[model samples]
Target: MSSEKIIQKIGQLYHQKLLMLVKDVSLVLVVVVAIVESVVRLLVVVVVVVVVVVVVVVVVVVVVVVVYSSSSKVVVVVVVVVVVVVVVVVVVVVVVI
Candidate 1:
């Protein structure tokens, strides 16, 4: 056989041997990676949920924490109402994402 063809045959045979040796290991690696990816995705979802809940709770606490002046009662009411509504909308959007 020509040198080039002989080299090509050797490469093919070497590849076959390498594949036979690593097939099982390659499968295991794929499975492990998939599981790790799934776990990471779950953790991300959980973190997002926790953050949204904390934001809502903090906003609610702010309404209780601030002592408003009587003159600015209407403004305070409007601000507080606006903040709460914004928070709710943000939570919804974040959760959907």
Candidate 2:
């Protein structure tokens, strides 16, 4: 029948349109997923770099404190020794004269 043929053709065209819409949706989904993955990767790299910089700064601060403390102790010892030597010499000279 002519009506039957027209109905069949219309059904085929509808099916084809549905397939095309599905393909377009799939392509859009893939692009969205790729964009999300890239953003996550970038955030991870930024976090890692920030952590490493913080660790390095802490290490440097600790090293500076240790070095300054040791040097200050050495300076105190040297000053004490010099004062003792000068006092002893002055006392000896006063006694001899």
Find the candidate with the highest TM-score and give its number: 2
lDDT of 2 by residue, 1-97 (tens): 6999999999999999999999999999999999999997787667656655655565565556656776877656655655565566556544533
List candidate 1 segments past 4 Å from native: 1-18, 67-97
Local accuracy by lDDT, each model: 0.76, 0.71
lDDT of 1 by residue, 11-88 (tens): 999999999879978999999999999998888788777766877776666565454435577657757876776687
- Where does candidate 1 have its weakest 10-residue lDDT segment? 62-71
lDDT of 2 at 75: 59
Which pairs of residues collide in candidate 1? none
RMSD of 2: 23.0
